[model samples]
Target: MTPEQNRHAAQLAFVASGAELNIGTPEECPLPVDQLVATRGDEPYVRERFSAGLTAHVYRIHAQGQDWTLKLAREKCKVQNVDGQTSFLNEIQRRADLRHLKHDPLLTDRLSAIVDTRYASFRHGVLLSPWIEGVAIQAWDERQLLQLFDTLVALLLGGLFEWDLCTGNTLDDGQVRLFDFGYMYRFDPLRAFNSNGTAMPQFHAAERFETRQYFAHLLRLEQDGERLALDAFTLEKRIAVEAYQGLRAELASRGAAPVVLDWLDGIIATWKRALVNDVSELYLQEAWRSHWLDLHDDLSGQTCTPSTLARIGWLERTARERYADVQRLVVVESKNRLFDQLREARQLAQRWQVA
Candidate 1:
């Protein structure tokens, strides 16, 4: 869609999403637009700048007698390509959908784990929310994994798919909170496994976390010892298997199509078996897949972060040291071509590292 269309849809979606709650409006917002844009850093009203955001300038401000997050859209998003250019628009669209979900009492608390948008103006390029005082997710504990999968399961059942679960997008302060929606999109959960449909059944809630966040952490721990890394994956898988089983039953009762239920069943079964029998094999297979898939995503978006560089290193080291193991798992179509592409991506990543 055109940029104008993107902004319009996002604004309308935000409005429609919040219609039931009447959360707050721009008119009620305590931050004056002129003063907000003019204030360089913490005003008597503002506290800190969260410069890590890509498409917007985010600041922690106190307004309306409480602390809040105020985001102003950047004229040009620093992300390199189209997705980056439109991320703010897309974020509001998804945020609108997520905020609207709280109307259902059963879903209210479950989806409340998602960040709440107090006010947004796509045209004016500003968004507001209560400030989340939390720590960035650096390590995955059992509770964190379970909490994350719970949020994912809820979103999936509601037909919303979150494409980005990067560490920066998640936080923990007694509970996991998802605050970013730039890559989240809608789909018919009953009709499809994910936004990709049944074509890529492997990309589900558990797999997405493993790919986007967990395995990257495992890669870091690889140097400590294989045992530490394997222990981490095992812990995550056990939690995931239970989470998927819960998801499966929920969808089945909701009258989801057999295809969707069966797809989830198969994943749950593999994870179950791996957990019961031995998890080492499953760990290798998933680690290989997660790292490889994430590499392609980073390359596709032309947004390589330090994790991108780490994933590339993991691929190169694995190909060199464990080509036989990958062949045994049959993780790729062709080993030689995969290695060639990895080398090519390595070169590109050096230059395209997202600033």
Candidate 2:
């Protein structure tokens, strides 16, 4: 079966399996199943209540001499899409795969950045793991970037494609860690670009990270000055270039399809050439793509937040001030038309502020 068919089968099996899909042993649970279901923020053991999530109610609960994150699925998910609706199940499924990957000695250290699943039950809509005592990455330093890309490379080589790498999904205690897997899916790394196979080659791991998270960081830097933003972009691109080179080498050794190897080679060559000469053009092109695509994702989910409006603002500003550059990169025939469309998008984004 194809990857999509396999995904469908897995989703169906998860929905039907109920308690049979539970991870970890019963002795590993922080609380009894019945008592855990009864828990809410007000409970004394519940240390923190994070109710902002669209798919689940998350809480930091103190139990069994430790704090653990307890996630309970919402009765109705707010994103209004199939992926959003099934995200909890997806998380559970990925956790099962990740658990095995964690046990691999070669990857034990590199994959430690991924959070471990202690207990999960599809029927009860509950997932639990040790609480991460970490803060959101305020800035992307070299250490954070290297660690994140290392983890990402390991994940990709292991056949997992993580679509969502947003700020909320990553944390930094002493090391960068990915704690969310709702949008992560399985694929054949040697044969496919991502879970969708070779059909969507444009949506690679680095592109996902830049679109969902890093470009937003660069956008903030842009407001400071173009020079600062360019410097940061160059730094990120250099790291990405190195990571992709290593990834390509490893994939080739593993007998990855020529199509996959060639795709990686193309990306590497383009970035390498841009790095040697001027990175400004490439920066403008990718920044525009990332912001526009991320905005589309937010609008599609009907889950627009302040960031969505900020992106529209950037689009309008770029259309007015950098029309020539954007046109050079993305084939815009009419600047006025682009600005008008952005204005309309801004209004719609304003109207759909769910966060």
Instruction: Highest lDDT: give the candidate number.
Output: 2
**lDDT tens string, model 1, 171-278?**
898889999887777777877887766667778777788788889999888889989999999888877777778888888888889999888888888888888898
Return the top candidate by TM-score.
Answer: 2
lDDT of 1: 0.80
> Looking at model 1, which ten-residue stretch has the lowest summed lDDT?
15-24
Give the poorly placed runs of model 1, Cα more than 4 Å off. 1-24, 37-44
lDDT minimum window of 10 residues, candidate 2: 12-21
Candidate 2: C-alpha lDDT: 0.89
Sequence-dependent TM-score of model 1: 0.90
lDDT of 2 by residue, 164-238 (tens): 999899999999999989999988899999999998888998899999999899889888899998998899889
